[model samples]
Target: MVIKAQALAYFVVKCTFSGPQDLTLDEQLIRTPGIWKLFVDGSVAGKKCGAGLILSSPEGFEICQAIIFDFPLTNNETEYEVLLAGMKLARSLEAKHLRAFSNSMLVVKHFSGEYEQMDPQTTAYATKIKDASLSFGTFELSQIGRENNGWADALSRLASAKTQSLTGSIYLTEAKTPSIEKKECLEIRQGADWMTPLRNYLEKDILPPNRREELKIKYRASRSIIINGRMYHRSFSQPLLRCLNTEEQYQALEAVHEGICGEHLAGWSLAFKILRQGFFWPTLKVDASEYAKKCVQCQLFATVPRQPPEEMTSVLSPIQFAMWAVDIVGVLPTSTKQARYCIIAIDYMTKWVEARPLSAITEEAAKKFFIEQIILRFGIPKICISNNGTQFNGNKFRKFLHHFGFK
Candidate 1:
């Protein structure tokens, strides 16, 4: 009976009803080979902030790391920092499949795309996390209860603690700056150009092998001198002007044309200003002209030309009263009959003028004045021109024009 029970227990242990599809996500992941689990937690005590991370491999081996922040950061930022640290550690280990857990709901939600990140700092952190996630074949982040994340929570609190009384082995790290802040390094390369030959010839007495080029450099070097390691061109009537390279030419033009105390002068004026400031380039005038033209502010606020582009021609009426210009001049001081507006008509060729006063400038008043003062008195005009006022452009005025056969 004892041997039968042992065989039955062995058979039960070997048999499984649940297939891979029926297994929970965590169970499936646990059974997968080469998968890694990450748990991260962040803590803030008083003014200090810190984070803790725990990474476990499929074989059940674990690595723990603690981060002490030297800079001030909020709890949410700390959570993101710890997560990012975990991701870096996994990537360094070449872990292909990663599953991360965080006790902070905000961090998880932001990473999972369930919540919008409104804070600029956190948004930057999220973008960095997303970019880093692409390094792994499979990456998952889920929210867990703080109680369930006890080991990471304890490690985080330990990081914030002043004294560590109990510890075996943990990688303690210090973060001097926020991860989201980027440090930019700019490399300036001064390549060979027109100034390079002159500089080489002047500084080291180096000259080209060609006889013609050698003679040209020798002749040009006569007027150019080196002062404090800088080449300068000798001016007959002015101080020595510093010769500039391609980059320096651009800088000089920008400073003179649009820098602080810049007057936004024209192209030629800009080149002269730079020359007055003791700088010279071969294409200074041309470059200055192009740069000034390209300036958005200069183009936008440029003065408009007052004169017409083409030759001026006078418009002549073939006969008197054939062409008339009608206009309204208004809002004057009250005069007799409480008239505060005046409607006037003029003959284009004869310079004849007729005027009428109006209490209100309206379509009806304009029609009556035009009919009695100009049309009936002088006959219907072949052409009439007026400012685009409602009284002139209204439907009633248009119908009156159509009825009179006026263009």
Candidate 2:
């Protein structure tokens, strides 16, 4: 067994010290024919930021590019920026199979899906890279040590430093903005709206030529003011209320009536909440009501009214202090006195109320309250009504009431 172990150890050492003929599977695959290699690096020096890319063709032809960024970017963002630039260059060259190398472990892992891109900017860059990767037949990204990525790192530093002198073989370029910035053309057509007349009357003193329309615009614009180019309504209740367009009105209603802090309130309450939030539209109340009526969740789980279909008969007392209604009002939040229960008595005729707080509700406590608050202060009542609770209907309370000639 000793000889066998020693033989195995010697064989492993021999393979470990083997020549280039015994290259690992990864090394052999990386050197495969028709595979283009891309080395990317990014650098940020104080306020300046830049990236560098070195693309090597299978035929050993190299393309080195240095990009200086006009916008400020973080270290990881620069890494992704350079990587995306390199991929675009490779795609233009018609590279079918590409293997990218970066000294940034975060960039490599994010591209390979080992690390999640939590930052919004980096995530956008990662998404763009993945979409661009479809242009190539095969794509692979690997992380290398900073020392191994010397040439790309040097070019990135040079670009970041904005060195005036550089080798003629290195292609230089300037990026005015980030590669991920959206540049789609948007067409904005102006149409006549309510705010347009008011804004015009307030800002440019422009109004309709007709006498009636001109008078109307002048009257409306008198109640409106322009601050920082935005029209606001001069409100009576509030200092100023921001006016909303048709689109903004809908957004505000939806957000206030059903957004995260929304309670699915009634239309009137919803409109009031929006007003309190400093947003104003001409039809805010109507729009809020309509929005609430259309809410599926509100309708599905709405509370049904418990009112009688016919009519509710009224209860009457002959004279003041002749009859009293008694009830307990708590298990409320404990007060500083450690009292959590309250007993209340109300006269049916005059509607006089008497209340006392208690730490606990017991028969003795109920009886004591009845004598002190009811009989002592307002005289004895002819009839005493309760909810038939344990504290009010207990044997001791009944006996105490019986002793007092209460029927």
Candidate 3:
């Protein structure tokens, strides 16, 4: 005889922990190396109940999971459900060491023994966790909030009663929004190619009975032939070319170029590689070259050809105080109503630069600055060059420069 779900939940909680808010854990120990990680979060609204679990290897990310619960459960009970299931999952995977995280402070505190066992159900849950931990290499469970936990939060919401997360299905949709593009995964079905009929006719004694058409097919099939159900293109200089369907060809190309044991070959190398492996398709050479062209990883790591686009060309300044290059820098941080923009002038020969800050960059202010900083201090320049900004290009600033006889 089994008790009601609520009664069982209450009993488990009562056994494992007291209803006090004072439960807490000490500073977490240093995380063990090569330990697998598990993230679990539970959701309960009205009477609906659900849990989410994400397990990951030390090197790879996001090990997939499948979980479902029908019984009525509180948020804490649901959390316990997730925790137990996750731990069992870790054990089943033969994971030697494990670390689990949850958003439930009560569950983390109670299970970690920072709180007293006042509820039997809680006590039961905590006891189970202790027993389960010994089966793995090393196990630790800690608490985290929803902050910076977008994936776990989204997965949790998806598991609730109002929503169902189908595998690889879109969960949330905003109406009238543009759909996102997705990558295509290639798969090939057996007997879905031109060579299938030839293979069947030659190997399994299957044939269409139109004598004339059949004879033609047999004659053409002889030069580029099917032997023992494997299609091969006859070659005079080298070995026969074995045929592959879409998926097999893709995998073969990957193995040749970028597989775990691949050499990351160039286009011609890749084409020759498939031939050396005795695999063939009509577009084998073209496909290998195209694959190398479209390979994102190879493109990212490949050496870029580098050379100067044109011959060296630079204007040499004749003398000091003859020419000045002028520019303005910033709308920088404002302080005590001080200026934010700095007007800068560089002497072409001496490499000396003079700067003055102004609250505003304007034609009038720039004229005044030129008179004080350039005209009076450094004498007149043969050429005053500046970028075509409003302050430099305006008719008034040009007239001011003309008044100072600056070219």
Candidate 4:
């Protein structure tokens, strides 16, 4: 027979005539009770931070969570966050034993209790890790090669590169709250700003009892109101602007002149834009001016050349459906009823065209056309564009827009 000349070769998974002796690594893992395998990774690129975690149970079940951090973070800090998040996830799963793996040697050593955390930030992270680990009956942290950590590493890179957020096992988290420090929420007490007294009286109706102060508060508060716990500054010229608290004011300042959508606008334009966005802060003009001075991009990139007075000026629309251009066509040959001009309205973005035929193109006809065709049909727009035609520039049209909360 062909088998007569062959010699047997024994391997780990091979069975002998006596019995099965040795087991493969996979078989050994399956025999372990309640053991969960965890892999975690983190990355920071272009001032963005992301973390990824993968957990495998003894039954070969795998789950994942991909995290994206809005604020800046270092690689080690991100790694710690991933590890802590993974442990918490494991505890939630009722895992009593865990074998965690990571490519970060620093994290592995910290968790193994072989290294001291010298950095104050790292100390807090290590403490949290240690505290989270106590729930497990047995826990082991070790470092593996990057190749073996492909899932988590790839997940971290994916989260970092994602332009938009996704749902289900992936989340975009904003960590603007203070790190490694305990701070209280901003509270607006009296004398914080000029509007403090006005706020106290308007919301709480708790006016100071001095005769002069009470009169001043009453007069100033007549223009303000509380809507959904937010104080507002109202005007006949624009929509009601929600006054910002101290923390929110800082966020608005940063978002306006330097945040992602910021083009570093000038002080007046910046203040007006913030108000136009339906936000108001005390000392808006002064704050915007101060913040603009510190913007390096604006100092280097901004150059507003003066334009001719009547050279078809262009104003940028703030957002979608916020601006509309209206103009009158020529006084055409009279139809059956002598209808002359047509008032045409078009949205700046969507190009949705609307037109109204007019008998005389008088101010009254224009007003009725606007109220019916534009406001009732679509919605109120922030700005209405028109030339110096008396039909549009008349005082009545101005009052029409003002009463409708147009900007």
- Per-residue CA lDDT of candidate 3, range 1-407, in tens? 22222221110101211111222432223224578877777777565554566676665445433233546666777788778877877775668888887888888888777878797767777777787788886788877666633444444554343433233322221112111101112113554765666676667767778998688667646757754335787766678787888888898998889876888887778888788888777688788888988989888998886878888777558788779888999988885568798999988889988888889999988888888898889888889888889999999988987887877
Clashes of each: 0, 0, 20, 0
For candidate 3, the lDDT comes to 0.68
What are the per-model C-alpha RMSD values against the true structure? 28.0, 24.6, 26.6, 21.7
Worst 10 residues of 3 by lDDT: 175-184
lDDT over C-alpha atoms for residue 393 of model 2:
88
Q: Tell me which of candidates 2 and 3 scores higher on TM-score.
A: 2
State TM-scores per candidate: 0.39, 0.39, 0.34, 0.37
Which sections of candidate 2 miss by over 4 Å? Answer: 1-27, 160-166, 170-172, 182-407
Please rank every candidate by TM-score, starting with the best: 1, 2, 4, 3
After superposition, the stretches of candidate 1 with alpha carbons farther than 4 Å from their true spots are 1-28, 170-172, 182-407
What are the per-residue Cα lDDT tens digits for candidate 4 across 1-407?
11110111101111112211242225465347678888889888876677777777777666765566656678898898889878977886778899888889999898777888899888888877887788888888878677767657755764445342322332223444323332223342323766688878876779887999899889878888875345688877988877776667778888887777887786888888888888886588998888888888877888867886676856676577779888999778877677877889888888888887778888898889888888887778888888869998889988887899885
Q: What tens-digit string does per-residue lDDT give for candidate 1 at 209-319?
A: 999999998888888987534578997788989898777888888878888899999778888888889988778889888998899999899897999999999878989
Error of 4 at 346 (Å): 65
Top model number, TM-score = 1
Q: By lDDT, is 1 or 3 better?
A: 1
Cα error of candidate 2 at position 160, Å: 4.3
* Span of 10 residues, lowest total lDDT, candidate 1: 4-13
lDDT of each: 0.78, 0.76, 0.68, 0.72
Quote the RMSD, in angstroms, for model 3: 26.6
The residue ranges of model 3 lying beyond 4 angstroms of the native Cα positions read: 1-32, 161-407
